[model samples]
Target: MTILLFGITKDIVGSPTLSVPTSSVTGKQVPKTVRELKQFLGDTYPELNKLSSLAVAVNHNYANDDDTINSYDEIALIPPVSGG
Candidate 1:
């Protein structure tokens, strides 16, 4: 799965896109849900865990923690926005 990063998430990740293996190449379980995805990303990129608020979207729709994900799904990480 490829995760698109926006705002601070991009800076934190050092890239606009991240590729996640569908199969465990490192003996770690592949993320099958939004919640697990977050945990996986946080584990790989500790800086992401520091964000006060983070939102995830799957296939252009906002996804909840329990939302199921697949290798072919489009995932995006949206950080909290602040504007006047």
Candidate 2:
């Protein structure tokens, strides 16, 4: 599965996307829910935990912790926005 990145997230991740395995391979762990995904990402990319407010979107809609994530699902990380 690939997780799209936006704004600061992309900068921190050093790319526009994150590739997470759908099945455990080479000791990699797969996340099955928004919560798990966040935890996994936070562990992998500690910088993500520093965002003032981060949002998760699935299939173009905001997702809750309990929201399910499938191998083929679309996921993205959005950071806080500010306007002048």
- Model 1 lDDT tens row, 1-84: 899999999999899999999998879999999999999999999999999989999999999999999999999999999999
Cα lDDT of all candidates, in order?
0.95, 0.92
Residue-level lDDT of model 2, residues 1-84, one tens digit each, is: 998999999999999999998888847568889999999999999998988988999999999999999988899999999999
Cα RMSD of all models vs. native, in order, equals 0.6, 1.1
Clashing pairs in 2: none
Question: Compared to the true structure, candidate 1 yields what TM-score?
Answer: 0.97
Best candidate, TM-score: 1
Stretches off by above 4 angstroms in model 2 are none
Best model number under lDDT: 1
lDDT of 1: 0.95
Give all TM-scores, in the order shown: 0.97, 0.93
